[model samples]
Target chain A: MTDSSVPATALEVRLASRPAGWPTTDNFEIAEAPVPEPGPGQILVRNKAMSVDPYMRGRMSAAKSYVAPFEIGKPLDGGAVGEVVSSNSDDFSTGQQVLHALGWREYAAVDASQATTVADDLPSSAFLGVLGMPGMTAYVGLMDKARFQQGDTVFVSGAAGAVGSLVGQLAKLNGAERVIGSAGSAEKVRLLTERFGFDAAFNYKDAPVGEQLREAAPNGIDVYFDNVGGDHLEAAIGTMNDFGRIAACGAISQYNATEAQPGPRNMFQFVTKRLSMQGFIVNDNGHLKREFFEHVAPLVREGRLIHEETFVDGLRNAPEAFLGVLRGDNTGKMIVNV
Target chain B: MTDSSVPATALEVRLASRPAGWPTTDNFEIAEAPVPEPGPGQILVRNKAMSVDPYMRGRMSAAKSYVAPFEIGKPLDGGAVGEVVSSNSDDFSTGQQVLHALGWREYAAVDASQATTVADDLPSSAFLGVLGMPGMTAYVGLMDKARFQQGDTVFVSGAAGAVGSLVGQLAKLNGAERVIGSAGSAEKVRLLTERFGFDAAFNYKDAPVGEQLREAAPNGIDVYFDNVGGDHLEAAIGTMNDFGRIAACGAISQYNATEAQPGPRNMFQFVTKRLSMQGFIVNDNGHLKREFFEHVAPLVREGRLIHEETFVDGLRNAPEAFLGVLRGDNTGKMIVNV
Candidate 1:
């Protein structure tokens, strides 16, 4: 399509309705729309990769969350990586790959100046997975917010997910004496310890989180990056050392619960240990943006940071990929390759 | 007991039994012992007043808390104010008022070197209140831990209690635009608002703390000095603004809960608002001793800071004073005048 072209487009899945317990196939729908034209300072990019995360479930319902809920009959937007096909601005060329908050669509006309340019050294899809929000979240969370020390013991929950996998690797790279992780399956546990270089890994189904953590971190946990809240947070609270710091990046476990979650039962432990639990969102904590790119880019180029992405081909399968992320079916980043 | 010629003799109270919930008169028993002879860097003092706090509940029970539990059949120690009856060292002298952690006792033979000389210009009783541990707790929690800033709206629970009262006054002095406090009775409410100059005060006994705080701080709260956790903490959570700071100073409400407290059902507000909740003990942060005294002395001297003392007549009444503090009956610092 040319820069001025305005063609009709169809999306195979828009959030049709909010889910009660778990969002079923009925929660999303296939829809069509007229393709938008590239306005001034806009460039039309054919999306190559799109993301679906557990956090998106909170955005699907109309309830209040860190981000707004997805509207009915409208395409859900997340981190997207794509190649520019048509442009009306000097900053963007027709062939350059970029990353932005583009919706699950066949094509989009985004402002050329908006969104970061995907680094030229890596695969364009990496922009949607590791080198994007998830990567920044791990880096900034570990170094800036959690203030993890060189020899600190770190525990990451939902350790096989996109952010957790990276968090484990980064913790080790940052000179953590020990890195422990918990995932849903034995295969994920193996991957975390062996492939991701986590010092210890456990399949949460095999044992209670408290027991698993106690065995894994005998000296007590110094830093905990909580992804799944509920019982995982409870366990971490039990095992934290004095002056402990916890970065509450996400709570994937209780995200889809119809009823409210019972918070960690042993919060009194926080008082005993003089702990600090800070809930954070990765919004480029100003100085960490530069540090993150400098540290992560080289690791990526050297293949030290391995990325695994589950891809669903075409715009039609985007809804299914998103559902898969909420189900924890994806090994790492769940992406739609449209 | 004379300093040079008279053999050292001292009167003291020791812990007899651990209490179930509230400490009683039987839990303590008086004992006569040789007055501690001050060695090198030691001072002998005659105790004038002693401080009792809610945290002493943990010390009495054998439950693990921020501090160690008191040994059974041994004297319980905490912030104590005394006049040095005899001195063997240069740091202290006869008739000089001093402060030390020597509670449930009269006429302590503390090492001259161990006691901090109560500032000359400030009230002697202030050594157990605003100029001592309680005052230091309020300062550090507000300035260093909470990172409270100008124009912030702050809410203090247990408004008329020693730490809570000073927290409200200091918040106002530090340029907080709105300072709200919650107390148990109408008289406490009046004391907080009218006497202490709190922007708003509500009797928590008559109303839900959440509703009261919502009405009092309609705009939202920026900092919360959480002295009485449980429902007060839940209410504070509901009214916190984005990036809110909560200083977990004390939890008098939750301490005596016969059953498990149903945690604030809406704790996810921490995630949405990006809240930071940190627990601290003043003694554990010993590095701030000089800074705390330096900051508080001038204020106490100028009458910018006022400390209320709820005094019991004798060492025999120490148990009742401690029990009264546990029941939230004390308006300020609960002390035993030995």
Candidate 2:
């Protein structure tokens, strides 16, 4: 009782203010607080890592979304890799590495059921990347929702990001005849083809996406997974085959615009080509989760699936990490070490 | 020799010239000739009616589709209702009423396998309305593609036309809590509620679609089957529930526009609502054909499905019928009695 009498403690980072436009480093602030003892069904987790995604930018804004807005003065929540330090539930115990939804913080006291026990063989961080929501999204949208067939041509936008990278690779492994990607930099384009097994990749900034996409997918695309919507979507539409399928996962280009812009003007191409463009939130595709892990885990083990992690030190840098992710600074998965 | 040996001639209507903008009477010409003789698997049908759709406007403009465009100085082929006069294959029998693909003129010779026997109880015109491609398009888009659920709210544009009328009624019968429709005229709005069983209907011109839609679906739309598209789509995006689905059947508003007049301005609504909008061609849902017939035939026979047909007296009026259909002059399906 000697050590316990002093009471436990945890360090937390919270949303201090809502952003006016693009969130700055000032939007977040660190705070010191007492770590409460786990009360029934809850577990105390010492977070080791957390995820930063383009979607998080919307959460920071007051605008509505499928998920609720982040409450000011409360810590933001997203995918996190942590270790259970103390548990009051049988579902979690000390020393067990876990993945949960705590973010921008050093530690968390959360319900045990909220945490998922990732596979022992895979990197626990993978639960935040290829084996988690992003990976499942790619798998479901490409295979099940798109009804993708072998030998079909595939295209992916934001191809160097965690989700898009897997989308490109998985299409190849699934026997797609050709896989193309669009990225922001030469290095990313090269990485897509050389490291990620994409048949072709382009620097969207240098070339008009439509012209570049036509060159990459000479025969036209059968399926497109869109992460960066705007012009990339416009270009993809120009090269889509009759009855092509587009999976709208995210629109990074339109995320931070202070001024509104009409996007991807080629949307009418949908009518001419008789295409199907579906926007889906991945978690609701839960029916495919088990299948995604089964398919992707083995591919990772065989070294066919390659992923990159860009790490930022400390939870205080979480805002910067998110900004970087949205700006496409991260080569692959953007994560923070707490 | 018997008159039958003379190969009784059939008059055919061909597109004399491409229309300047909206088609005029000068664009079509009918010529009488010998009735085509049936080939090994073909049948000669005495065509009762022929339909004209807005999509035919694109076909007339030399644009490509799953089906070939109408070549200038040649026949404009589309869905036609006819009765088999002679059959050269086991699939068809003489004197049986059937539906086949034919051109604008009376009397057509088609492959017997391409013709399907129509129920004697239903009006021949129904084949082009609630029992044909338009009906199947609305049915499959709502039931299968959109995954429309019971108790969901639905919004449909062009709600008095062949496709949209069926779309609204099916939504109501399939357990929609609120089935709202938007049409071009006050009369169409009235018909939508009284005839099509729409929970509510509005004249899009009377008020901005966004405002009307907000008032109509305060709880937000779960499904939107878009035939009008353009402004209606923008409004629908604004009124969509989280994870709402949109089936893009047509965009009549932009169909005849020479230039894409700055597409919808509210693109951010897609990201915020996590809405899914998809376009489809009827052929893509061919697998649903039999099931569609099974589901809709009973509703039709029971008078639960009400269809409208605007018929012209002769092939000479085909051009006027087509122009009228596109201008929203027709209450539902527009056909020619050739």
Candidate 3:
């Protein structure tokens, strides 16, 4: 790869404005910028894929959250995987695939220190989903935060989404007695039970979450990996056994709500059942990355774990892809192929 | 003392009927029962003081809770301190003051194993409040459940109540930078700061808990000892700093509600602030008793701690005393002295 072959200009996605409610494509804009050469200690990469996650919604608004809000008129950044087209650092060479936080763009001049070299054994998109942030989020949220035990009954909401899809499988693979999941649609519910090896799955929209969760987990759940808060959280609390643990990963249900949604009506059960609920951000738990990879990478390599991705072609459609993620349109990891 | 010294017939408070919402005196019955002699390995105790706690309300109803419901025609049992008139076991001696769970009665024949002899260093009523279940609850809830750290800002609801009153003092004595409390009455609010050493105090009824808590803890609270749930829990969640903790000791506000109430609406803050909320029952954490006694008993003995009690004379008025507890009429521990 030479400087002559690299494109002079490339497209990137920017936040046009903040949305009052559910974001539309109009909130995003595609702008062209000159692709730059790698400076000292940097690598110029041709981005192959980018991730569009539900958490990014928090960054879209100006409200203070765990992560800083995305600046308007600047290209949005997230998990991305690309090939090093040019390198000016000893850490990387041309043609090597690296993962970095420079997504929603065609090419990025990433600092070599910031980008990590990923193995060629898996698809580049795998770095954005299964072997990346979502995968680690699932591992830490269940194994550590929820303190999942062998033979424990585990329940996860948003069963078919990126992080959620892996949570049920991880619990099952780790010797869970029964794995239950709640999803928005029958198809996702099917995916949860059949593909993810969950013992029971329910479409949360079909009936009240508490009723369905009770029917699905009659004995009660010991560990709850909460991705969809609101009714799902309430149902989990209601159906939890004594000393149950709740990993508050995300509250996607209330992300776009104009008003703050009411929490579980059965919170008093927290005292009665002696339940523990903890909210966490995956970024803070990077210390567990090596342990997570050691356990999960093999599962992905042997095809024991499902590494699903729902890809939307081209950086131009990244906004639409993000919108699809918010609408629960994607079954698993929703990715944008640049 | 001899068996003849023990009264042959004693007054006992019984549940005449379960209440729908707010309980009235009609819901209770003052009955007479023959006080029995101590059986093998039993002690005949002349009840001195009995605890009239908010938790009794839960047992009054037939609803499934941590403990079994109070039988309709039987005497309600709770923490009570009494003088043993006769003992059949070597563990206790006659005339020894012991604490047992045979409250709401003038005299009780208790199994020696169920009664523990309390020291005379503190008032007999202290065994039912600061040195007993409520004391242990405050200790475990703050020290273990909430994992309180030195210099942490602490907030406790129901600050004038038994369990809550001790929580603020314990936190302050253990080197808390600030201790904020919320009570139901203006006088209780005054008592929190003036008598209990709380840094700031507010009457929750005077304003919204969120606004008042925000004003009290401008930098945000690190630990919330929740006794009154509902709005208090929500407000605490809102005013909590990153990595804050909530010890859900009790939900006295919802104990009498006919229907389940909605929980915190701003629960998303749990994730945003990386908060941890744990509900606990003091019975489960009995392992920490020795540690609690070592730390707290000294405070009480030295007069560094306040063990206030509002006593209602005679077992005939036990139900009224319990109702007073439910109505938040007591300053500290509500007791029925027989």
In the order shown, the candidates' Cα RMSDs to the true structure are 2.1, 3.0, 1.4
lDDT scores of the candidates, listed in order? 0.82, 0.82, 0.91
Question: For all candidates, what are the clash counts?
Answer: 7, 6, 0
- Please give each candidate's TM-score: 0.96, 0.92, 0.98
- Candidate 2 structure quality by residue, lDDT tens digits, B122-170: 9988898789888898898898867899999999999899899889888
Per-model DockQ: 0.61, 0.45, 0.82
Q: For residue A240, what is the lDDT in candidate 3?
A: 97
For the predicted complex of model 1, DockQ is 0.61
Report fnat, model 2: 0.40
lDDT per residue for candidate 1 within B172-233, as digits (tens), equals 98899899999988888998987888999999988888899999999999999988888888
- Order the candidates by DockQ, highest first: 3, 1, 2
> How does residue A313 of candidate 3 score in lDDT?
95
The CAPRI-style docking tier of model 3 reads: high
TM-score of 2: 0.92
Top model number, lDDT? 3
lDDT of 3 by residue, A101-167 (tens): 9998999999999999999988889889989999999999999999999999999999899999999
DockQ of 3: 0.82
Worst 10 residues of 1 chain A by lDDT: A3-12
lDDT for A34 (candidate 2): 79
Model 3 lDDT per residue over B1-338, tens place: 35567767888888889889889998889998898777899988999999988888888888888899999998889999999888888898888999999988888889988999998878899888999999999999999999999999999999999888899999999999999999999999999999999999999999998999999999999999999899999999989999999999899889888888888898788788989999999989878999999999999989998878898988877877888889999998888879
